[model samples]
Target chain A: MDNLKIERTKSTPYIFFDAASGRLRVEGESYPENVVKFYTPVLDWLHGYFAEGADNITLEFKVAYFNSSTSKVFMTIFDLLEEYVTTGRMIEVVWICDRDNDVSIECGEEFKEEVEQLSFRIEAC
Target chain B: MNIRSLYLEEEAVLKRAEGLLMSQQCFSLDVYRELYEEYRKLLKQMKTLVNVADLTQAELKTLSEELGKVSRIDGLTELYNRRYFREIFLHTWQQAVEEKDILSLLMIDIDYFKKYNDTYGHLQGDECLKAVAAEFQRAVGHPEDFVARFGGEEFVILLPHSDAEAAIDVAKRLLQNIENLCMEHSASPFGQRVTISVGIACRCPTSDVKPNTLLDEADQALYKAKAAGRNCFKLYV
Candidate 1:
């Protein structure tokens, strides 16, 4: 499968998906002017990559802050990951948060609880 | 693996996916690839559209709060308007109680301002308002100090951690600043220059005492300053 790389913008996160290495990363803030317009193509690439399944994969999320709109989009992404885990895919999802931002830490924990199927870890970096 | 290997292998994956080559998989790789491409576009678009509608509902909650703030500023003085003044006054009063901080309120009025407006015309009255507002804004150097245009010819200054002494000092300096500007007011009462009257009230505010308690005291003191012949300040007893 092809790799996907999206550059960071002021209101959106940096996204990188590598099918060969089985690694996915989203880093930076996420509160796009139009969340749908910004995340559509990237999620499309992710769906395609997930279909071409690998045995083991990990997605790293290091988001400083995200609006509620962006969180819903993230819930979709995590739910997709959770589906793969339920189907016996080895998926380890890591959410890295800054120490000062307790809200980010709490959000990661909430996602972990919500997506019970995926192996989720909230690490304060 | 290290990031370099991951990146290099990604380039290799792109090479294969680019060639339109079919890999060994569960079923017809060509058919699966075509189906995945077709399904990916629709699936993502559908998911995102559903979420977008849900997001706007939540986004509107925060949007209204921001709009409230933007609308709370006075157009002429570029200072907070009366509504936000009351909001912040309550907020600061609450903070003072929580942190055991001193809070002070200053009610300022331009002496014989109606006469100044009548003598100099409304345009110059507007110019005077802007200049005075700017000067007061400049004088309050602390980031937390709150200032608002209370109404015509009146402004409020809130100093959240200051005592009566500090408030008096600020009032004195503001008087000196206006005196130095020497804006002409040939109407009547005071001298040839425009002057101001200030009233101050300070306390470690608590719920036992309302935000209005200090405002009323400051207003009373302002009245006293006006009665004591207009160009000075009085502290609430």
Candidate 2:
């Protein structure tokens, strides 16, 4: 599978998903003008990656802020991770938040609860 | 004079005065006094009307100004509003193009907001929107970045000299922040958590393309995100 690279914008984040290392990293503030358009390719890439039966996926999310709409996209990513984990592939999600932001910490917790199979960690960055 | 006779006499005197005035004869000082009194009374009434008209005009001007202020403000989030957004967007876009800087936009919407509003009361839904708006404001920290509550549960963030990568980082942070809020809505299909969908559009502003086109592209990206799922970010190619 080819690597997935997304350039960030003022209203969105940069996404780098490496198929070989199974490492996916997203970093930036996200409040896109159009949420679906920004996230679709990422979602499609994830779908294709999972279909390829990738192993040992490490997804790191370093976000400063995302609007409610972007939260839904995060959920989709988590859902994909969960699917991979259920299929016996190892999945790790690292959620990075600012040290003082209680909000990001809680967001990580929410994802942790939703995806049962994937290992989720909340880190202060 | 007797009271009745005095009234008649007064009437007769008034008639005589009228006759004298009609004949252009010299009038009594008393008659002149009476005419002056009548003139004064008429002048007083006219003066009152004029004062009332002036006050009414002043009040109207004040009301019009207040209305203008209200209309200028964004109704939903009470932000600087969309009218201001257009002015700033054009200026920022122009500046970016001239400086050869990247201008990025994020169009965001509350995921399943309509459903959320339907399930919870509009009051609760409004609270959700307020919380989201506050989160967006915090995310776009740069002085040059313009964040406006565009409409409904949607918002737009404009970042000047910001590339796609920088915007994505901001978007991710915002996504994580809202998740942390832990506001529960059981009715949400996305689980107890409330989420959003974002669309990102970035380019060096150019003479050929208007800012609205960039916004439209971002909006298109957002639609793709929604189509794929309730939560996520999609970027315009």
Candidate 3:
């Protein structure tokens, strides 16, 4: 699988997925006007990576503000990672936010609570 | 998966469960139990996704409304800012033209504002501006009257459905209110205290008249007021 990199815009976040290192990073605010249109390629890329029988992957999210649609998309992402972990694959998810951002912290905590197999951590920077 | 595909996949899972139920007699108990368990897990995940989307959407909507209100108001004096004034004033003017009703405008300027700022500093100047703005709000009691901070050391008031006589009365009341504030302005030449100059313009707006003409007329009157004296009102012909 090849690495994927999508630049951030005023409305959408930056996405960087490294196939060699198994490191994925999403940064910036995510409030795209068309959430599905913006996220379809990213989801397709993830599907390709997982189908290649990837052994270990680490995903980090440093999002500032995300609308409700993006929140649902994140849920979908978490479900995919959890599916891989159940199949004996090593998958790690990290949520990074500012210490003073109560909303972001709460969101990360809620995601951590819902996941069963994915190793998740919330880090304040 | 994307939102559309995610929902489609959920529907497909449900159809698979339905298909298994239709061929129930053909399947062994262990196989049927495993299929049912998988169906239940998929349903649970779908439920979680919908719930999170709904909750976050409601939160973002409220935040967006609050930001809309904040954008319309001036940060310092809590009065309507120039941008909002420009929008609403145009709307009000259009309404006046349609109804053939009189519209009055007031352009107000603080006398010796630069001197006052030099003596008391910017912090106190801001306080003085806030105090004057508060007095304007109090002096204009009519529901039809609109007040806004035009810019630094300048303010504007719109009096709808009011003629020149009524507008003049409002101007007199405003002058008295500011004089009563008695916020000492040692730097001013007018009575050794803060004072304002007022310019009034009234028109029964017509569709043919440009909207900015009223503003220009009031500004001219304000110039005349400043020329006559530091603390007085002038009416445009």
Top model number, lDDT:
3
Name the candidate that leads on DockQ.
Answer: 3
CAPRI grade of model 3: acceptable
> Which runs of model 2 end up more than 4 angstroms from their true locations?
A1-125, B1-70
lDDT tens readout by residue for model 3, B7-90: 555676678778977876577788768777767766666566555555566667888999999998899999999999999889
Clash pairs, model 1 backbone: none
True-structure lDDT of candidate 1: 0.81
Residue B212 of candidate 1: its Cα lDDT? 86
Lowest summed lDDT over 10 consecutive residues: which window, candidate 3 chain B?
A: B1-10
Provide the global lDDT of candidate 2 against the true structure: 0.78
Per-residue lDDT for B204 in model 2? 88
What digit string (tens of lDDT, one per residue) describes model 2 on residues A3-58?
99989888788899989989899999888887777777787788888878788888
lDDT of 1 by residue, A30-90 (tens): 9888877787777778777767767688899999867766776776677677777889989
TM-score of candidate 1 against the unseen true structure: 0.53
Q: Write the per-residue lDDT of candidate 1 for residues B92-184, one digit (tens) a residue.
A: 899898998998999999988999999999999999999888878876857988889999989999998998888988899889888888888
> Rank order by TM-score, top first?
3, 1, 2
* Tens-digit lDDT track of model 3 for A24-52: 99999998988888888888898899899
> Following a full C-alpha superposition, what root-mean-square deviation does model 3 have from the true structure?
4.1
How close to the true structure is residue A6 of candidate 2, measured as C-alpha lDDT?
A: 85
